[model samples]
Target: MRRFFLFAGLLALLSGVVNAQDEFVTDSVLLHEVATYAPYKKYQAGAKMESIPASQVEIAQSAGLDQLLSRFAPIYLKSNAGGLSSIRIRGTAADHTSVNFGGININSLTLGQTDFSSVPVYLFDSFDLQYGSSSAVNGSGSIGGAAYLGLNGNWTDGARVKATASEGSFGEQLYGAKVFLGNGKFESVTRLYYFMLKNDFPFTRTSDGKEFDQENAMIENMGLIQELNYRFSSKEWWKTAVWIEHDWHQVQALMSSHPNVPSETLDNKHIRIWSEYENRRHALQYKGGLGFVHDMQVYDNNGEQKIGTDRLIAEIEAKQDVHSSFGYKIGAKYKYIKPDVYAYSSDVIDHEQSAAFYLSSFYTPLKTLKLTVNLRQELVTNFDVPFTPSLGAEYRLLITDLSVLKLTGNLAKSYRIPTFNDRFWPELGNPDLKPEKGMSYELGLQYQYCSAAIQTDVKLNGFYMDVEDWIEWRPGSIGWEPENRSRVISQGVELQSNTDVFLRKMSFNFRLNYSFNPTEIKEDQITSLVGKQLIYVPKHVATVYLIAKHGLWSAFADASFTGERLADHSGSAKFPNGTVLDSYFLMNCGLSRDLKIKEQDFKLSLAVNNLLDNDYQNQPDYAMWGRSFRFTLSTDLNFNKNK
Candidate 1:
């Protein structure tokens, strides 16, 4: 096959380079090196502020991401209870982007967001977010961006164990444990996390829709990530690695009782699995996996009447992705979707599948300029094929040893086919629909200055994107049928800055970001959304953090703020006029101290979220947990740093 030959040629080329340099060729491969390196010191501080993994970008210096992230006005966040929500890149709508776990195509699922609350940072080797029109490597219907989560490899050295506990404001309690075992060839890791949110959360509003009594909610998550690698005794170039992961989650629902009615109780669960295999450069990497989700909702209709609703989903996926040092990277993947909803006794199931292939060029002719052109074609089980293309370029200008001028741009065509729930679910199914398609563009500039005494960086970026067939759901005249007759147009801008100062034993970092969006609807029936600020899309969001480090001691302070915005499609009138959730700022403060236990070095940290006990609402009808505190202690033991 063409792929086999391409990979084989690249392997041969790489082997010769490794033999000469005694290195893995990572330095010669920018992208691969970015994935393997720990990142520059300047970037490390910015990652903590943005909560985005460092592997997502390559820069020798740092900039203010907090300020830039705030400009896009993301709806949900890692700090929010609903779940981890990322900013819409290039002003694209949420539906335009594709979401992925490992290599699984999660873009076709019911929910657009993934919960990152339970994934222990230590277990992840790296996380990367590709902005604007993901390539075929991720499958189709991805117009906005793609986020990849990678687990650590080469865990076959020895055995390791760690445990931690923390308690914080709002009756918050946290506990976690992890175990790692390896025999120089096989590896396994198990992690468990438990978080409890009690009634101690404060509420500033009153019973008349004002600040009422504080509410409470709780959640539990358990996950296991295992990887096994086999190295050929004779063929060191040929190796196979297998990965498996499972995650389970449960949560307590929030109560909405600003008036007199008691808060309703809710519970839900989810199970997911991911697996993949890689062959170094010997051939191509093969990956495939599946996911199953069960969601149940129960509530009292009118105090005496009880109602229940359930949703079950099954998703299967398979793909073959290849990376080469020759001229390009290529991949193909397929996904099958089946979802059914049950209310009382009636039920409906919807089925669909998606197949796609992508190609990315890797050869760059210029020393400072790198360009990549990608194309993908996808076919839905019952729809026409859509061809998407993306182009990206990065230029690094060496201004001086301590500073560099970096410029980057991305252009892509995107599309999102209707989901099963969007087209076939009872009371919400719309079969007569067209897949939404779009185009996006972005350009950014960065400057960095890193030295022994001080480190500082500043970045500026401007981007815009538009979409058509922006699918919006329309309720069918019948109690349980649905139609799609809505579309939308969105545009926005972003600006950000970051800086830091390094001292004898302390470091200070600062960041700022801002965004602006004006959107509208095209249909008359959905006119209610016209000229109204997009729901959950804040105009401005910002975060600031300060960190200090001393002999065996580290301390930090962080604060985040979101501007007031519309709550739903109705905007004002019918949706409760002027129901604007007041804007409030939340702060977190923590301190970590190093300790020596036997031959191991342990670090203990105590932190409090919402240190000021500020009352806030993540949603108009739902309030967020009040001040919470946690204590975490961890230590690492390693027998080898370089192999």
Candidate 2:
């Protein structure tokens, strides 16, 4: 009854606003206005960069980052019963892929991986995925690829407010609010969000094949972000942003037999402050920024284990457009990381520092040919960092008024440093471990066609990567210790296509993506592991989606499929070949309605996830949730009457 009253009040307010307006606004007109004035721009280089569109972002804002990426992108996510999730790209480990926020690396230095489950999709205005080796554009540890998230500072000439509320299965609830205010020269933006979930869904145990209800699984999270921008002059501006977040989760057991005892709990806190200045008045444009991050994690079992990390980052870059067909960029970056662990007997306070310099040049010799070269050098405190270099080329094969064909290729060398836990852990740390090194090569072709009625794009790419001195933990004489003891080879092919057709009063969009990645342990100290596939790395994955929009209504359906994968390494005797997980398919659908009143826009959306209720597991023994449903209500209002 309360919800009904609230909705009724909102409808009354909207009706009043509609009566005050001079003309009725259609959804198509609003969409066109947004597209014409939006500040976000997609990357257009020859590299295989994919940007998430604003429409898709808006639809996925209620979901977490992991769910959005796993369903829409070609990446793979290994989730443990929807509680803890990690990402993999191009058949590489989680640590090999970097996640950056506003040009700062956000991965944990102690764990060497980012937990995708805890990240929110609404925190950033734009998301970009760069495939293959990107250590040249991004920093180190990008052997597989990189993901970039950024907030656009450019604001329109008015003030706007947006709020969203959602409720879903498993006792899920979410609320978010954002405010944008600008007056041409100065702008301010703030966002706040809160989420909670019981996570007590039922699942079947893979070992015994018995259904049981999950317990002791609850999550609560909240975050706040504030950004300020000041345009000192027509050609220069300054921007600053601060973010704070907290998360608490209750841990659950992997199997029914080994139920959680003493009730484990985990808590995480993160704070970041970043600021930058840019000047583009002269022929040479330059930008610089400074950032600081503080992260803390605590786990409570019988006792408490706490870890804290502090990072300081500084970077500067300059770009010069020497001519119409050529340009160059030079940059330098420095990072210092300090970590403290309270659970270790030994003094677990340590610091690591690194500095890197890079230079990139782009040349166009002919109307249809372009080439790029990049070089980077790094110096670390106690480790030997390698000198990385890469070369990329693109050529237009054919060009016409309505169609174009292009070929692209890239080759690069990259490396990853060992984590602090790998080198400084009590009694098991290895101080002499070498950094993992790898080389990657890729080639692709893209074809695009556009006409009055339809537009289509298709791309096909293949990549191969070879790594030496791969790091792994093994049973030593004393205890388990980290070592560089294996060689790996990963090769894959990716195919993607997108089509959009415009009709009289409706539009149809379709997308298809598929990846075939096979990673193998070619050489290992243990003879049994050689010539075996890497554990948890699937060989085949595919996704498809179709969407239709007509007037004020829109609908979409999508599906994803993941192939079989080994549960454990071949050398392990605890699990045999039968422990492999079978392939599974997941389907989802959504329907949404849009409404406009004066300068305000309202949307109501209903989404059904896991529509088939397939019982499956991304990780062995960790079952996933069944079918689930969610409903969301969101509104955007412009408060400035001058518009």
Candidate 3:
């Protein structure tokens, strides 16, 4: 109720922001808008990037980032029962991957990572992924990769309202609504979502065939977002957005500890506000954002813990137009982190601040070749962070109206800062720990074929990285403490293929993805740990999916496979150095039909996840859900500008 009242108040306040505005995105030959705060324009000349189309975005609006990425691409997620999920790209640590909203790094300052489960897809208009060490572009915490989520300005002259409701197995429910109004100059978008789940599905222990019900796993979450865009004129515009969400969840005890299960619950709340201004004529842009998060945890022993974090960020950049065959961009950014944790040593609030200046240049000496150089230097109030630099080149061997082939390569430096827990924990924290720094290199080949009826695109890439001064908790004089323990060398191969076929009355789309990642500890204090794969990082992953659409009916089937993974860092005393987990396969399929009733549009879909009822464990002792069904219905109503 409080959230609703706040939403109403903010809505009423933004009601007066109607006026004229201009477009936000511009077109370029090779690299488009790669602004830190802008939408995903991943058609970068020498970068390995991926984008989920608007169709998929619309279908998964109520889902989480984990769901959207996992369903559409071949990515790996470390998931546990009771609504906990995190992502890894190219075998990087969970914290090494960064997720950004409106150009702000949303990773937790205390834990150094974002909980993908808490991020909803309903808040953004775009989903983009950049793989393999984008720290030079996205600052620290992007050693592995970066994800950008943004909302775009709307200039269409129409007002539309969309609503969706869903019910699924194991007591799941979801309701969401989106209201959008736009004129030639002003646009307003409002979204509201509520979801609840009682994850009580029964699962059988693979080893003993013992049956168990997933108990004490319940989740309730709700949120609202309002976006307002106004073009001051053809060359200047301003936009702002506000979001608020609250969630409550229970973490079910693993089956192994059933008899001794403890009652544990967590409550979380998040609030974010973002605003930006841009002038295409001057080639200048400004962005600012503020976000707050609070979490409370309660255990069975009557002990409770609370944590709060606030993030404030600002950025300004200018781009110089082409002079000769070269163009460049320069920007500066600042970020502040305020953390309040009951677990900290002091009762006073602690804060961290960092600022960075970055420069990037684009040069095209020939019609078929493009080159880019990026450099960044960050200054921290505490530790001395190193400078990051990147070089990229793309060469087109063949370019024509019908087909094209290009080669891309990049070399970059990446870094990661010590998290709050790593530096300020009650007693075990280490403030003198060195920052994690790394270097990465990648090469790729891309081919595209297009025709009136058929289109195909294929890309293959390989990457290698070495990270030094890896931070981890180790046994010290008394207990475990954070330290720069070892070095890691990660290497991987990735392949992606997409094909679309348009028929007289039907269209078909197919996509295939495969990745082989092997991350090994190169230099560790413990001899036995050397050459061992990181825990929970898979060596192989593959996915394939197809979408077929007719006049009013559509269907999709997607499947993914994970290879065997290591479950422990230390090998058992007897044989192999570590405990290995079995690989598993999963499949999901859905069908939907569109209907036109009077003036409104309606859609109904049925999806079956884990279609094979396969048994799998993302973590030791934690079992995943089996086959389940979900039914969703959505309605869309549109009114003309005259209305």
Candidate 4:
């Protein structure tokens, strides 16, 4: 009780650190930046894409990307005690979803996936999720979905700085700082963050109902993003950004272990550099970019295993207006990858060079109807990848001042190339593997209504996808070797709603999302596995979130539910007839208050996760952290405003 009063007193005292000023400004100027060669434009449309609200992202600023997405997105995240988290979209495998950095696919060349735990939610200015298969725009490896991440330039002709400090249960500490500076022509965005967790939380054993503190689960992560934007004229500009991060973690033993013995550690480092130039005009608009990604990781089980990859990419694209109702884009891209690993056939430098061409056209004969056609072709050395083509159309059903309804549909073909580990892992690797090809169909209906009293949006979507020559690892004569084995089928339905209600002095926003996904193997050598749902894939997921805002107070709550998942066959009592994991529901909530500390803006927030503190496990033997509380304080100062 005394500590609470002292904390309140300190907050009150800090609220008067500066003199009052009337020129407190809050807004940034959105600057034009060159595009990074994409075949399908978002506005012209191909898939169901949604952007995360900036206001809602504030609560997860210090948390990882998995935490943020788990609160809103309907996809399942196989989070291993908050340690190795990966995304599985609509029952698709983690590797099937492409994680792109500024329009460039940056999934590991060795593992063919990205660790969601390695990404900080505060690094990017904008985050978007694209539903269904989008290989026509996102390139290879997007068999299920894609996430586009980038930083936007907000040159507001002023200097602003914000510092954040947070502390949570179980020895959680977070510190971050952000700076934004603009001089009309030159703009800079700098972000730095450091977070650590001594994950020594208590957990109960599922076997005998005993308890023990989790051990060997410490994590320390830090990152930096430095972006600079320069404008040459009203229609031309350049952008350069550098991102660096390091994550060091100690692997935790399973909760079922009494004297836990897993003492492995993971060390990961990432460095990314990108630069782009865009010339925008009436009809002839073109963009060009050069980027590089450097990733290295070391894992220790009994001995240290090291792997690293370096990738360089170059792309250019131009768009023009052919007629009043027709437009088209042409682009070409090239990527080179080099990998260093100890499990390879040889230590010799092995480099892969690939080139691709992208073309798309947009036509709108009437104001209420529009169509787009996209095609992409790629060439690799000594291998063949199927050419991809897609078509999308949108038609407005009703348009008025109070409401609008639209119908959307898309058909696309996609493919995924074999990863380096699948093709080069000593004798077990299969150099004769083939690319996985897939075809997908989508249909959606969207309705929106807006007025002074309320605003609402509802969307219903369905997708069916089939993949051929799916790669699988099997026991061969030499060992486990990769092979093009099974044909899989995935289908799902999604329902979403976004609503805003305005009262006299208060406003409320509600968001709901739900999906029913079923993925099964169609053809496989193992007959029993055929027609069975993929292990670790869930069939149902949903999330509901609410945000409320008043004069100086705001609050948010998120509730998420995941249905039963198919567990791997163990032939035990627990899995006598292919039994599975049980469903789980989780909730997170936060409350925040905004304050004016003289000339600066201040915010204080309190967040709680797993409010119910349910004793549950995502899978067998892996226990959750139960519940945790976090308190954060942020201060921002702006200078040279009204420029």
Best by TM-score: 4
**TM-score of every candidate:** 0.76, 0.91, 0.90, 0.92
CA lDDT of every candidate: 0.48, 0.77, 0.76, 0.79
Residue pairs in clash, model 4: none
Which residue runs does candidate 4 get wrong by more than 4 Å?
1-46, 301-304, 346-349, 475-478, 640-643
The sequence of per-residue lDDT tens digits that candidate 3 reaches over residues 43-132 is 134667777766667666656788878766667888876877888888888899888777667777777887787788876777778888
| Per-residue lDDT of candidate 4, residues 1-643 (tens digit) | 3443343233222111000110110112111112222333532354677667676668788778888888887789887664688888877777888988764786888888888877888777766777778777778888888887767667647898889999999889999998989887888989999999888888988788898888888888999999899998778899898889999888867776656456778888899888899999657899999999999888863234678888899999998878756888889999988786867645433788889998888888887777888899998866798999989887888777666677889898989998888888887777789999999999998776666656666778999989999997777888888899899999989877777777999987777777889988999987778888887778888777778899999999887888888767445685764858888888889999999987689999999999989776766787678799999999988874653
Task: Candidate 2: give the clashing pairs.
Answer: none
Model 1, span 214-305: residue lDDT tens: 43343333334444444443223122222222322223234454334333443334344554444433454333333343322223223333
**Candidate 2: stretches off by over 4 Å:** 1-46, 258-262, 301-304, 343-349, 570-578, 640-643
Candidates arranged by TM-score, highest first? 4, 2, 3, 1
Error of 2 at 357 (Å): 0.6
The best candidate by lDDT is 4
Task: Tell me model 4's lDDT, rounded to 2 decimals.
Answer: 0.79
Better of 1 and 4 by TM-score: 4
The number of residue pairs in model 2 that clash at the backbone is: 0
> Model 3 clash pairs?
20-185, 20-231, 21-185, 21-231, 571-577
**CA lDDT, candidate 2, residue 378:** 87
